[model samples]
Target: MNGEGKVVCVTGASGYIASWIVKLLLLRGYTVNATVRDPNDKKKTDHLLALEGAKERLKLFKANLLEEGSFEHAIDGCDAVFHTASPVTLTVVADPQAELIDPAVKGTINILKTCTKVSFVKRVIVTSSISTVMFPRSPLGPTDLVDETTFSDPSLCEEKKLWYVLSKTLAEDAAWRFANANEIDLIVMNPGLVIGPILQPTLNFSVDVIVNFINGKNFFNRRYHRFVDVRDVALAHIKALETPSANGRYIIEGPIVTTNDVEKVLREFFPDLCNDDKREDIDMITKTYKLSVEKVKSLGIEFTPTETSLRDTVLSLKEKCLI
Candidate 1:
């Protein structure tokens, strides 16, 4: 469907990746109904309002992932819904199902259900993670390149230990099941570690990782990076929505680099932040893993190079005074 004049609802509109998606959608002349947990949070909404054409076309709605029908109002009369609201945290929670899995799965079901109720809704694009398709399973062959077809085996998820991975896997599976049973046009975009500069420095999660690294918080001094820029991932979502021929899953993979590679880039770009005298206590693991992007490429999208992505991320951090 053409997004020229269509109204689209983007959940987690204040987030790192979702905010970019909202900005791009507004720039493309699409009306955006951006959902946030709290509409009163001026700090977040103000940045979105400041985006080009956002004030004219963007609408903010308060919604919760666990609350039933919370998204219905935001999605009402909308042509498409971009479900990017899901819990992403490093700390393991007590109840993975409640904190992570339930929200991811239930929120998807809620959004799709709302779409089914609205006849004008033709597409539902979900923001899934590469973790759903990539790690957790031992590589079958020497080539670790995973694709849309690759799914993380739940058997590999030890109870609630690797709860984040399990949550994504279960949530995505639930989405597919609901889509197939309801016969809805469902497309999922699985992005790797998302890193980039943010429209608002306060809303930058990807930048936090870079900042932590610069501050020597990465305990092992280890480098094992697999990431994609938030901008590219946002563009992929827009493409998935506009490209009617696009269906099923797409793996959005960026160039694979290690922590050392990130450090090297920092040293070149922000020498002030790089301490050569500091001992490298971190371990660097350069394991080969490829995420097949042929499907997304077929939809006429190209990803930025790993070096460029890293530089952009570093530059963004520097701009925000994070590094």
Candidate 2:
């Protein structure tokens, strides 16, 4: 289960979290097979190649999640697979099951099925969201802190929303079921709103949040779930892969802050871009949801502080000319 000499394949390697995972794996001296939709997309893989030690240890493979057995070649001879590829769209799609549910569930099943074919594949680390575990129950209690055991109720999934949460829940459920049935080692990392700097600013979804905030698009002052740094989430993935004792679900939660907190940070850091006075009309909806990291911490993982995360994210946006 050690990653020093082992080869690990990461799905959606060019993605926000997966890209960081790929970099960390390379830095740890693990050979990384990064799967992208197109290997010819220089814009995607170029940033990954630019990382230290990536030139020699990193390999890019063309793969699609919907295509059955496409991941077989990428996962061949690999000791572990990090399945972080899943559709995450804020707007409600016409067919939630088609766009989110089926892809997430089927893609996870496909990857694990491929893992069953490879004897060397001992561990399968899945990137699940806290949305899968939190936000399902109706009346939020004051002390409701979501933990690893909590799951989003399927009955609560509605039309205008619930698609994303439903997708993650079903996808994770399928992974656990397939792993147990096939006897594959399954480890899931459930991360809250992933923030922090982007390795490739242009290709990351987290960066889009920063861009939207800077552009004053997030005028809604609703309080949401806590945020976790993408770097920390990446580290958690590496730890989950290396730590053989790590199993089940681990909740990666950071400081629980509201949209006002984000605006305050932006106003303090980049006052020129953010109008402090314009936030008066912002409506803040506080939802009682806190993810317990005690389980993940038991695995010897330490998360970065919230201030550090926000500062790093702001600095990264400025560097990318997004603010």
Best by lDDT: 2
Segments in model 1 whose C-alpha atoms lie over 4 Å from true places: 136-141, 219-221, 272-286
Clashing pairs in 1: 220-282, 221-282, 222-282, 222-283, 223-259
Whole-model lDDT values for every prediction: 0.80, 0.81
Estimate the TM-score of every prediction.
0.90, 0.91
Top TM-score prediction, candidate number: 2
lDDT of 2 at 191: 88
Off by over 4 Å in 2: 273-286
State the RMSD for candidate 1. Answer: 2.8
lDDT of 2: 0.81
**lDDT (tens digit, per residue) of candidate 1 on 1-323:** 24577899999998889989998998889999999998888977888988998878899999998888888889998988999999887564888778888888888888888888878888899999887886556654546656788898877865436788888888899999999999989999998778777776583555677767666555334446666878889999999987879999998877667666777776677576653324553322224555578898887778777677778887776786665
Give a tens-digit lDDT track for model 2, residues 1-323. Answer: 24578899999999889988988888888999999999899878888989888888888999888999999889999999999999997675899988998889999999999999888898999999887786555644667766787887766765437788889988998898888988999999998778888877473555566567777766234444366899889999999887878999998888667666777777777686652334443222235444478998887778887767878888987887766
